[model samples]
Each structure stands twice: as C-alpha cells, then as structure tokens.
Target: MKKDQLYREDYFTCPIYFMDKPEWVKKLNKASDLYIKKAQKNNQPNIKERTKKFGNKGDHGMVHHSTSLINDPKFIDLQEWILATAYNLLDEQGFDLKGYQLFLTEMWVQEFSHLGGGHHTLHTHWNGHMSGFYFLKGSERTSCPVFEDPRPGRQMNLLPEKDKSKVSLATSQIHYKVKPGRLIFFNSYMPHLYTVDNGYEPFRFIHWNIQAIPKGVLNINKE
Candidate 1:
C-alpha cells in the first residue's frame, strides 16, 4: 500500500471552534499561585529565569508535567467538567465522536509561571488525533495563541490597473488576544507559538492538553 496519510481526517488546516469560558476564572485564579509555586519547587528551578529560553529545546516549562496530577482530587474535579465542555463544543462543530470511534485517552494541566511563555511549537499526543489548550489565565496580552498562516509567498499585482489594490500575499502571524476562559482547538500539526514578554507580574496559566484516539487503537498501561 502507499504511505499512510501523515495526519488523521481531523488534521485541520484551520481551527474549527472557539468557546468563551467566563465561569472558570475564579477557580483558575484560586489555584494559580499554588500551582506555580508547587511546580517551581518540585522542578528545582526558578520559573522566571528557567523559562526564559522558552522557544529553544532547553525549554524548562516542559518539565512541570507529572502523572500524579491524575490522582489529585482538585485536578480530577476541574478536569472532568472542563473536558465535557470541550468535547461538547467539538461535537457541535460537526465532529461526530461516536461515528469516528474517537475518545479521550489522557488529560492534564500545564502550569506556566512568571515569564513562562512557550516558544513556537505544536502538540502531538502519543495516541491523540487532535489537541488544544484551555486558557486559564495570563493570556490577556497580545500573544496568547498565534496561528501560523500556511500560505506564505509574494503575489503579483496582476489586476492592479482596474482595481486599486496591491496583491502581494504573505503569511503573517495572527495574534490572538485571549480572555481568561477561552478555548482554542486545532489539529496537532498546526504550528503555533506562545509569546514571552517583559512584565512586572509573573505569567501564570493552566493549559489542558487533550488526547483523542480511535477505539481499540490504544490501551491503558498502569505503569
């Protein structure tokens, strides 16, 4: 057979949906400082300084993930509802989970502390077909989620004589100024970057990573 398709059917060229979440503001803020502190302490690094090189391979922000969060009651409580809401939104967008044999395999929160901005990146879950982020906090600035324009080239002004328009096309980074409880979902391969800037307050955020896989294609390993 020919080479398998590089991406699943949902490998998106353009992100499908956006949901405004004003309710989770309080809950996220209440746990924000605690999550950041705990993550820094456990990782044995100053988040402010460590995540400075956010865009490079030596990205320290990547270290905060731990499977133990699955057992924490708080994590479970928040994640349960958060996930339900996300999937509902996805379904409303015409992605039929039942027909596609799709289901979530794992979910977790990523806590980014002072100046903790992700460099340009994309997410690919081990068995996931699609992934997204639930913006908890610290996304108010000009650079919460930046979607890369796939088409990048210079266009010729062919019809310039009749229509007064310059037709030069180039892929520019579109910045999303996100609010406290907004969700952005996209295909795993869509290139994106979380921006970093200088500010007085530490950048605190919680990102929920979701993994969707076809049934019978994945198995749970206790280890």
Candidate 2:
C-alpha cells in the first residue's frame, strides 16, 4: 500500500536559498557600511519621489547609486558570488540555461532608516529575465516579502471538498520574512511589496539587481 499524502505537487513561488559564506557575508556588510557613509555625505536626492515608480505605498528610506562592477573591487567580488550561487541553485533545480547571457546591471545601495517602511510594489527592471536581492544587514523588524495573487476567484470553481480543505487558500500568495544572508529569486514580472517594519529604531539594508540576457539576441557568445 502507498503511504498517505494530502498533495504531491510541491509548488513554490521561486527557487530561493541562503548562501553560507560567513567571510563573504561579513565583507559585504562592511562594504555596505562604507557606501552608506559616502551616501550620507553626498547630496542624495529625495528618494520618496525617485522610488515612486518602484513603489510608494509605505514609508521607506532608500539611497540609489549606479556603478559598474569593474570600477568597484568590493562589488566585483559580490557580483561573482551572486552569479555562482544563482547558477548552482538553477542547476540543482534542473533549469535549462543553455545559450543564455548573464549581465550584471543597475548596481545600487539602499538604506532603510527609522520608521522607513516600504510599500507593496515591484521592481520594473526593463527586459529583466531574472532578478533578486541579497540582504546585507537588517533588524528583526525587517519587512516581509509578499507574493502577488496569480489566480483570483479560481478557488470558487473547485469542488466543495476542495474548497473546504483550505489548501488553496494557503497556496494563494504568501509572505516571507527577510533575514540577513538570505537571497530570494523570482521572475521579473512577479508583483511584490514590503510590509511595515516594526522596530522603533533606524535600520539599514542593501540590495542590487541581476539581469539575464538570452544568447541569440546578443552579438557575443557565452563565455
């Protein structure tokens, strides 16, 4: 006889994992601090207006600056590690990435200060094939990551028994708490928003963007 099970389909929002590299994590934290200090000293713009397109639903602090990895030694190292980690996860998940191009673009630093909570929004990275973020540092009150509703009102069509089980309700868009060293990946189009941060004191966090370029469109071949 077969063992009993409720459902066999192990659905997930996306492939996400926490990379275990203590030294690298430390290095990233240090680098983030340096960047934050520099940003504080510069004439940073009012992020409230700049981040409007990304999401303006809640209160959040953000600092934006773009630079190439080749120009920054610290960022170069972080970029390499991120790519390696992403590649390894995709391999384990049996994702076919042949003839694909990987491009690291739009690198920036974001700092969430006191009562700096984020709104429900998604990053609109043009032609972004795959994107994600690495939490350099965060307080216990960090915001939660919420997945958008993929299918609405579809649950009503299910049979009475299926509706009564509450499985579908649970599967409907879920929320995840952000933590240090935790990296989450998702399709560029997926809608996501950050919930309110609870801690009273100021907090800090840094994240960057990763883009993938399909091989055929680009003139160069994969290295």
Candidate 3:
C-alpha cells in the first residue's frame, strides 16, 4: 500500500503590520489636529473637494498634502521601523531588495468627524507601488477598511456552496476592524474603501505611499 500527501497553495496574499507604540500614536494625532487648526485658520482647501471625482463623502473631512511625517523627529523611530518592515515584506515575497532603496513618495493625514454617515468609495493609489494606513484613533465601532479582490474573471465562474463543512471560499472582499496603533499595508493596485463610521468618536488615520528604486538614481528637470 502507498500513501500520498496533499498540499494546498495560497497566492496573492496581502500583508498587514500592527504597531504598538502608544507615544507615537499620540504624537500623530496631535500633529494632525494642529495642522487642521492651522489650515482652517488660513482657509486651506479641503482635499475632499479635489477628490470629489473619487467618491469621498464624509461629514467633516480634511486632508493635508505632502506632510512628510517621516522626517519629523517625533516619528523618526516609527518611520525607520516602517521602512525595515517594507524591506522585509519584499524579501518575504521573493524580491531581493538588497541593492534597492525604499523611499516614501507621499505622506498625508485624513481626519474625519462622523456624526452619522461617512465613507470613502473604492479607489486605488495611482503611480504608487505600495500604500498603507496607520490608525491614530480608532475603536470597535469605527469604520473598517475593505479590500476587494484584484483578480480578473473571478465573477465569470460562480460556484455553489455545496460543502458547509469546509471554509467558505466565496468571499471576494475582506474588511479589517479599526484599532488604535494598528497599521495595514497592501499593494497600491488593490481597490479599497472606507466604510461608514458608526462610533461617536472621531476617526483619524495617516496614509502613506512608498516606492523602491535602484540606488543612486537621479532625475534632471527640463528647462
């Protein structure tokens, strides 16, 4: 008699990182609040206006552009950890990042005060290799981030759920509940959306876009 072993393969997995730094979380929230106050005083335009075409609807929402928190001394430690984790993730995905350097192209904060309904529709970060979110203030009742399936032709073949005993394989979207000090990272091409806020407290998060390039690469501008 002969016996054979069966193996299951999983592909196209998204990675999530959870940060447990309480001090950094407080600093991030404080910085965002201060920036918002300054912007409001100066009458700075809200990002929601510019992103109207992208379907962002919230009661009170504002975005601060090009706010490089990574350079701030208060967030330097967290920044370093993020970069190291990025490289490690790449390595785990079978990409050798030895000769490449990772850099944050854009970093911004989104603050929302949801009294009733607030959400951001599905969208992807253009021209970005990787994108992530760091939750500064969140709770169980806060809106969660949902990611849709990226593969094409998934809708063409619909199968019935015959076996309830096994894990349900009909899921095309996944959501993560918001929690303080939780960070999530995913491919920039993945379409994701923010659900409506059900909690009484405000929701705040820092979003960042990252890119990896060959070492010593430079660009010259045209006259």
On TM-score, the leading prediction is 3
lDDT (C-alpha, whole model) for all candidates: 0.53, 0.56, 0.69
lDDT per residue as tens, model 2, 82-126: 677666656576767786756666566555544454343643456
Which tens-of-lDDT digit does each residue in 1-223 have in candidate 1?
A: 4588575353424554577777876776675556555655666654445556453333333434433344456656666765676567567767777634344455555454343443436333354545666666554542366665443331232222342243222333456666667766665545566765333233434554555554445444322
Collision pairs in model 3? none
Q: List the residue pairs that clash in candidate 2.
A: 59-117
Task: Name the best candidate (by lDDT).
Answer: 3
- What stretches of model 2 exceed 4 Å from their correct place? 1-13, 19-22, 41-71, 91-95, 118-126, 151-169, 198-202, 220-223
Q: lDDT score, residue 190, model 2? A: 56
lDDT of 3 by residue, 1-223 (tens): 3468677787766555555556578777776776555544443345355457565544344332334566876666767777777777777778877777888877767655555355788888887667788888778777778887676677467666566345355666777778778888787788899887764777778888778877646332221
lDDT of 1 at 13: 43
Q: lDDT value for candidate 1?
A: 0.53
Better model by TM-score: candidate 1 vs candidate 3: 3
Each candidate's TM vs. the true structure? Answer: 0.59, 0.65, 0.75
lDDT of 2 at 138: 60
**Worst lDDT 10-window in candidate 3:** 58-67
Best to worst by lDDT, what's the order? 3, 2, 1
Model 3 spans > 4 angstroms off: 1-7, 39-70, 156-167, 219-223
